[model samples]
Target chain A: MYRQGWLGWLFVAPALLLTCVFFLWPLALVGWMSLHNWPLIGRIRWIGIANYRAMLNDPIFLQSVRFTLTYAAAITPTIFVVAMALALLANGDRRFVGLFRTLWFMPTAIGLSTASVLWVWMLNGQVGIFAAIGRALGLVETDIPYLDSGTNAMIAACSMVVWKTAGFNMVLLLVGLQSIPSELHEAARIDGAGAWQNFRHVTLPLMRRTLKLALFLSITGSLLAFDQFYIITRGGPQNGTISMVYWIYNNAFSSFRTGYAAALSLVLLAVVLLASLAQFMLFRDREDA
Target chain B: MSRNTAAWLYYAACLAVTGVFVFPVLWVLICSLRPAAESALPPAWIPSTLSLENYETLRRVGAGLWRYVGNSVAVSVGSALAVAAVAALAAFGFSRFRFAGRGVAFVLLLAAIMVPFQTVLTPLFIVLRAVGLHNTLLGLGIVYTTFHLPLAIFLMLTAMGAVPRTLDEAAMLDGAGALTVLLRVILPLVAPSLATVVLINFIAGWNEFLAALILMTDQSNYTLPVMLVTVTFGYMGTVDWGALQAATVLTMLPVLALTLCFQRYYVQGLVAGATKG
Candidate 1:
């Protein structure tokens, strides 16, 4: 590092100032707001932990917490598996590898909301292709209600997310795979190691950091999922699809219970931080082992 | 198996995977191209008719399709450029300097990554409204730029580190100031990294929904993603599938084009950001 003295601070001032004003300040404000009865437009009154206490009994909020966990639990592993398979398939330089990579990564380029909208059309009962295929396969008497039921809505939303994001994780994993020098594989081959063994011994160990990062992003993203559920399911089928963030949004905007929403937001943040911390520990523990 | 058979088998496996990823997009494109009446027919790999009626319908939405398109483009591009400039400076400082509390500041910046912005939406909305920027495109762009800083700074720092110190040192010896060296001597060498930063930010800002949905309340101020949501659920709680498909295609077009053009840098940013974390 150069000894640039105060010049260094000048260079970093804009970034630091923006972060402080936009991110850190809001973060502190959220903490403060959670302690008050802050409505969208009303007199603010300090209520201590009333919002937090109310959250424990708020049936919708509790259900949202559960549903969000269920959705994240279901989607995170699914994306990781599909992305890993794609990375393995498209990792190396072969014919049309670039074509395949681009194809897989294409959906991710589209916004999640746009992808969700497309899926909304794709899952429509009358004109949806999925329903048409279901009929052609004799799977249903007519257009299956893909979004009408809670289980099916979960499935459709999860599938749409996998389609949208798996390729991104695939690219991250592919980079990790490629960064493992080809010579290691050659050395493993010279030792008569089989493909599975080579991957297990050489690849998995070396790819741990990338795996952790990808999984961290996937889990946190799934935890905060809102647009897909909001646009496609609209927290419908009797509110079975309500996510944590969705509930927070409803409280903050729909009900104008800004303080309650702020409290819920803090809880979500705690859960996400804990989840990521757990992942970091789990990966590092494996490294030690 | 013979080598030829192995190659064909490999191709077959890849083709199958590609079908799963590509068919949805192709199907969407086909559906978007079909006449609004024909869209109700059963799924067809081939469209019997082609029309732009659905796209034309998109123009009937509030402030028209072009308005939202322009809004999204302006916000995303503006935010991307702003982020690149700010992040380039921060990366330069962090990578090239020794200063008091530098490590602490870096940690604070990275901490933003850990806290998902969704959690802070309420306070952020309040803050923006207090500052009279809640419903404005500039506020949205500022939010995007602020959130993008950590990753952009990280990527730039890595890129700047890869450039030899001797290059900048030579410029310094010629009596060039630090900012001058950064602008004239260092930035040109890291153009690819700069592109990566811009593309990443642009795609993210263009597609960002939750913040935009929360912050932008006016129909006229809606970004494309928010507008799409309104078009989907806002019309007496009914979805006009054709218009939605057409709109989706329009939204994806710029992102896909940029990704294809900048695939190398885009992929580099993804991998570098992940591995660095």
Candidate 2:
């Protein structure tokens, strides 16, 4: 019996040790550095809550806050709608379903930064395909600056994300849709229900769990968005497209204010955690009640 | 239109979407051959003249290209293998043992899924600095492994649960040790789920951007996402549209090839391993 304990520990030891040393310990260090003034090269001093206070008042940080929330707000709906539509279209019983799935899912597998850079080439104001098409179509006489200002930049960046992520979301939703017993839909149809009615009543209820999971992931992922903004906008024509995480990255990595970045990171963490937790709790309550 | 015609209309609407989605990529493929100057306006959808300059430019910058791809492959494959190994054992523990805090431990692991790495970014960086891991490939690999283990462990447990404890009993009856059962019995039965775990982790690790961006300092160490971003940002003054487009096309080929080749195996495994867990 005693020998079994030794074997168990032996089996699990390697992973435990690695995670402890690498994952847990580093996390603790992050908390410690946030309370002190630690730089990449030299100098370290503990200044309790001063960094935190600065984060609250920093105008740049606030701009990032507004931008991140707004971007998350914009992308979640856009992505989900696109994904659901794709799922429905792909889920049909057709000869070309697999081909369509592959085409749509193609963009999702490409890296977001790669897509952003690719889109940048495609959106170059002077010689981009988009500008040429726009001019030819008589939509505009001149190139409309898509990335010059925050609004158009957000539109541009969010579109890249939608293109990159929508197919993935569709696949997940497709799985959920398939899992819903067809009996539910067949019975609804027996009562002379139309396509829209079947979707509204039977389909929607069955998808609650999947929808919740997808929504939460989309919301949280969008909140932490960084790549497209970093690549496509570089915080934009005037840094208007910069999000919260980008701001943290610039401060910590670019400016070398590691301590201040750590403090700001903690703040961002608290906010995201609270928001996610609230969403999770609401779902749990709704499910039970 | 008749009711039957409406069904055709629905198909037409959705198929039109497929066309819209394919348009940009098709334009890209066509323009890739066009002369750089002639590729611009008058809105030539088809290139009158084709050239290979764009492809040549990518070959010249192969180091910068290959390094990012290498970082991506190494980090992804490494994390998937390591995370799967850890998760397999941990899953066995959770499935077989009736220990205190088992449920709580499971809950905590599930809870970890919702915790975005963003909250821990600064902390994770500081920790990397303390351990002399920052700016290193190995350091970033460690972060990827950490992020994957929770879901991996959960998936492993669900997969391992499909394994019958009777096999362990039978093996034990023959004086086989627990390690022997895991090696000879449990591990083999859970192969499907293991494939799932590996595929899922590999995909997740491949796509990981924020951690790689934050932790790695040097350009030599930059993953594809960082490299792409850096190239785009640096070249903003006088952007090389041809080279950039060629690079994007070149980068996408590998991912497309992998997905197409592994189409059946990947999604099936991912869905099975992920669904219950």
Candidate 3:
């Protein structure tokens, strides 16, 4: 297998070339663009960190950060709790568990933008099924403006994200649950442990790494959320629901501030990297203990 | 409760949860079939007269519906194949050979997985434009293949690592060249993982929004996800809910079918990718 050096290079050359051109080159260019007044068309000029300076005082940028974090906070726990429950229910070798797993995990296949469109109809005040049901059941005399206000809009977006993504987490956590040796649970039962006690002691500790990975992905995804807010709410109700990526998108595409958007993108990358690094360190230490 | 009663309760609970998860898609499917005139308030759970009229209207309204679907299929399949071939080669290299700077290169590749696409949008746009691939489907396919390489390579690496080296050595002793061994011997053994890579990459490419949005500004080249957003938002004044729902169903049909058909491998690949990352 280790016969020749050039053969290994030949095997890896295509990947390396593609990555260098697509990934590393663009990454380096992002850093370079952040320090310039790059635009869609026209002359590029060096600005020396002015874009970064402007971001500190940009209210929309700050607001987008706040909303993104708030969205992540709201959505991650919701996904985890629901996913954990779904995983437990679908864990064992029970009847019809395969069907239950498929049904629960089907939404992940649908695109985010597509899900947003479907939710728009579902949460519509006028012709939506939910609204129709509510009116028929005497819950409200009038339609509920589910996406008209900031609070309700955020809630609507969060719910759509959870609905589309919780299934993915459920599958991930199910793998973790399945990987846990049955002997641990059997031992707990031998000590007369009830369901709650066994789950609390044996299942929880064993699934720690999987839970951390799931939470990490969910939080990162929620922070980078753009399509849901963009399609569902359009950052409406006074730009209250604009996630950070959406904000960057507006700056780059709508406003044509490529340099400023590049700066914002770097800041976001830093935040995500730092947060992930912290989570990894925290989990690693706990695992060792 | 008796054991029989407890079993019944669990079954009921599982059914209820499954209903909650799947009801929205079902509702969308129903809405897609309902005629526009009857699609208004107090929506019918069961349409009085279900028809393909909404789908026809969607085709007429979104004149580019078929083109978008074609673009999506082309891009998804093209990128999936490109990623599989490139990643399999790279994974073989990493898993088999003791090359110089292999560890550093692998780590750098892994680091690319963490870098969000937003950060590279501007620069990549400029580069693609310079290369005369600004809005072409090939340009989009290349970008997708490149972006997906890291995870694809990681998954393939794991798949190849599990293969015993003796097989490769035996193949070599039988006069099979390195490329021949990779293409015939090793690849056949890891065909399942290759399929998984293709499926995962197809979904990612199919669902990709921002890249497709920025790269393919031309409507004719828009992927399904981008086209749906554009058509829905572009003609904001004349929003057709029934047609929109129909288009969404149409857009989701391929990925949904793929997932249902290959769910076992999909889940395994997803879990492997996530845990390894």
Give lDDT per model, in order. Answer: 0.89, 0.76, 0.87
* Model 1 Cα lDDT, one tens digit per residue, A1-289: 4555778898999999999999999999999999999988879999999999998789998899899989988998899999998999898889789899999988878899999988888887788888888988899878778667899999989999999998999988887898898999999999999999999999998998788888888888888999889988989899999999999999999999999999999999999999978987887778743
The CA-based lDDT of model 1 is what?
Answer: 0.89
Clashing pairs in 2: A30-B123
What DockQ does candidate 1 score?
0.73
- The recovered share of true contacts, given per candidate in order, is 0.84, 0.47, 0.72
lDDT of 1 by residue, B212-249 (tens): 99999988889999888788785756667788888888
- How are the candidates ranked when ordered by TM-score, highest leading? 3, 1, 2
* Per-chain TM-score, chain A, candidate 2: 0.94
Task: State the lDDT of candidate 2 residue by residue for A99-178, as single tens digits.
Answer: 88887877766777677787887777776777777888899777868876789998888888888888878888998899
Over 4 Å off in model 3, which ranges? B40-42, B234-236
Better of 2 and 3 by DockQ: 3
Q: What is the per-candidate TM-score for chain B?
A: 0.94, 0.84, 0.94
